[model samples]
Target: MVDNIFKTAMRWALIFAAACLLLWVIMPEWKSVCAGLLLGVFASFLNALMLRRRVEIVGQAAGGNRRMGMGLGSRIAMVLLVAMVAYKNPETFNLPATLAASMVMPFFTLVSAFLHHKRH
Candidate 1:
């Protein structure tokens, strides 16, 4: 069930990233924004994958006495890195667009899970 949700979310993220790339190529005026969005989507996708792995690890350790973290710090660091890059390269990437896009993956996963639950 978790695997299905992860896969669906990843598929949607990829589709969105591709669309952003296509728009970047098709619309020169919007290139910076599209590129920023692409970068953010990539970061968010990676974060999602990391989160899925962390969830699996936590699940596996549920029966044990050891504690496991979801690696939130690492994810935050990744986003900060992307944001810094966008900020440094303002002409190449739009900072606001990048930040906004970075937030989209979790929502995608939530929506996907909700739809999956409804379908079943």
Candidate 2:
């Protein structure tokens, strides 16, 4: 299930990234928005990868799972750093669009999972 979700999220991310690039080419004025969207997509991809790795580690552990907090904390810090940079540079980064794009991963994951289960 996790594998399916990861693949789905990645597919959507690539689609959106291509769309952003096209949009950037078509309208130079909205370059910031496109860049922000791409950044968000990248961040979301990293987040998904980290989550998958954490799950695998947990599954492999025999005793109580440790290091989960460190993993989560680092992810949070990385996201916050990206967000802060975007927020600080409104001229280059469209905060609202970035945030909207960041939400795409989980949305696609859930949608794909639901559809997969329905088909099964």
Candidate 3:
């Protein structure tokens, strides 16, 4: 479990770095990297929070535990994972395009996941 989490985190960090580098040939300036990373981490946190809330609601409907127990390890792992994925494909096809693509992709993923879950 621990190894899986660490691996996932590193993988995401690499992806994040790559994406940042790709966007601006010089690699993300320190400040940009800092800001971008913060955004990524915070996004991960928000995703987790939303997920936790969702789980809590699900449990409640099912008449179970009210507390959603998302582990710290998982949260940290997600942060790292997002960072790595960005680093991996830092190359932006186009500034505006990349921005739009990035924004939509995750939402698409979420919708797909939800649909898949519902089907399951």
Superposing all C-alpha atoms, what RMSD in Å does each candidate have to the true structure?
A: 1.4, 1.9, 10.4
TM-score of each: 0.93, 0.86, 0.32
Compose the digit string of candidate 2's lDDT tens values, residues 1-120.
767767876897799899999999999999999988987887777887787788778876747755445678866776777688789998988888777776677787888888878888
Top-TM-score structure, candidate number = 1
Residue pairs in clash, model 2: none
Higher-ranked by TM-score: 2 or 3: 2
Question: What tens-digit string does per-residue lDDT give for candidate 3 at 1-120?
Answer: 323433344455456646655655554445344445445634543554555566557768687555545555665566555656556655522223323333332443455456555666
Best by lDDT: 1
Looking at model 3, residue 93 earns an lDDT score of: 27
What is the descending TM-score order? 1, 2, 3
Candidate 1 structure lDDT: 0.90
lDDT (10s digit) by residue, model 1, range 1-120 = 878987898899999998998998899999999989998998898888888888778888888956667499989988999999999999999999999999889999999999999999
